[model samples]
Target: MSQHARLPLTLDQLWQFSLQYYSAREIKEACLHLQNHFHGNVNLLLMLKWLDEAKLTFAPQDWSKITQSLGNIESLLRDYRELRRKLKVHVSDSLYKETLHFELQLEKQQQTALVNCINSLTLTDCEHPHLVEQYCLQLGAERLVRIFIQPVSSQSHNL
Candidate 1:
């Protein structure tokens, strides 16, 4: 292996990959649905998509840590988003706007942390690209989303 050959993909590269993939009209809806309705980490989802594009696959056995940490990170972002939403209507208050802006930046930072963490993992085993695509099903993303729907719906209603 060459010195420049072994590093994992960076988050900025993943972000660019996502921007291009998510720009597709077909995927835009599904991606937004997973993101907005399910409160999924769209960036993570995009990372998986990018990995799939590269024909990379993850072992099902390696998923627990990833999902657990992602849940924790996503939970924090959810809280920040909810609090920011509550304060958004009071934009006349500079404090509220500034605080909301801070929260937005915090969410981005948290996501970057997640991307970095995933990149740091010693991901091994290679399967068909479908492995990553099938992961959401195996992970029960729909079921998880259902659990949080009432709160998410109420949040949406507020918007």
Candidate 2:
């Protein structure tokens, strides 16, 4: 645990944080890069960011539970994402937009499940960089960790 107190966050708070964070072009690109190249789950990465921002840290077992809860939804989201990508070039603009919309819905469902899983776990006030590294390393995308932890001012944004 660290000297700073941990903050409790609700699902709405996490969702808002995700929306704001994802609005940044650099953050969006980095997350998509992780998802595309390293098979990372963007919702999980956003959860990690939410935890970091809240000054909360979970144990490995807790993380395992969170990931397990997302298993089914993750598969569905991946399938939809792949379909959306495939449709981008081959389908009409409206059709591609519909696929993208459904994919976003699936992503929201995953985030909801994640927050529920997190609510049931014990968390502490600890440094987050190590935790972030542990997750990114597991994905074999350790080098991209900097993009997540970098200062917001250092990143370019559209919003």
Candidate 3:
């Protein structure tokens, strides 16, 4: 059986800590645990035991349940990307409008300073890189897929 629960922290406690300080180290620790035990060469019997105990604060329930299918971790990545693709197609139109509305609202500012401020907003400006990475990792290509596959008749460059 692979050692998964070696981390001293519980997922709920870890989540609270993450919210408090926006720390990635603790979250990374839990991710490492998942990667080591669940993503890597998982031992079914032990993995199940860990799964029952884990309550999966970070990963989705289905992901944890997929231990039996995890012959190769890369397979999960492929599946993740494919799922992202499908989500993109499904939600593209709505997101396209949302993005446009967001930008337009930002643009509508009468003051040049506000427009500049909005334009200056960048990923680097965020206080939490790990949160961004985790979100992107979760979101994958869904946003891109949606934007790319949006109805051709819709406005393109505005988004």
What is the number of backbone collisions in each predicted candidate, taken in the order shown? Answer: 0, 0, 0
Q: Which candidate model has the greater TM-score, 1 or 3?
A: 1
Model 3 lDDT on a 0 to 1 scale? 0.32
TM-score, ranked from best to worst:
2, 1, 3
Model 2: worst 10 consecutive residues (lDDT sum): 150-159
Give the Å shift of residue 80 in candidate 3. 2.3
Taking the tens digit of each residue's C-alpha lDDT, what string does model 1 give over 83-104?
7778778667888878867865
Cα error of candidate 3 at position 78, Å? 4.6
Best by lDDT: 2
Order of the predicted models by lDDT, top scorer first: 2, 1, 3
Q: TM-score, each model?
A: 0.62, 0.84, 0.19
Cα displacement (angstroms), candidate 3, residue 88, comes to 0.6
Off by over 4 Å in 3: 1-7, 17-74, 92-159
Count backbone overlaps in model 1: 0
Instruction: Give me candidate 2's TM-score against the actual structure.
Output: 0.84
107 in model 3: Cα distance from truth in Å? 36
Question: Against the true structure, what is every candidate's RMSD?
Answer: 9.6, 3.8, 20.8
Candidate 2 lDDT tens digits, 1-159: 433233344667677778888898988998898989999888888888767655577877776787798888888878877777777999899988888778778888888888788777777776444565667889999888887876444132221
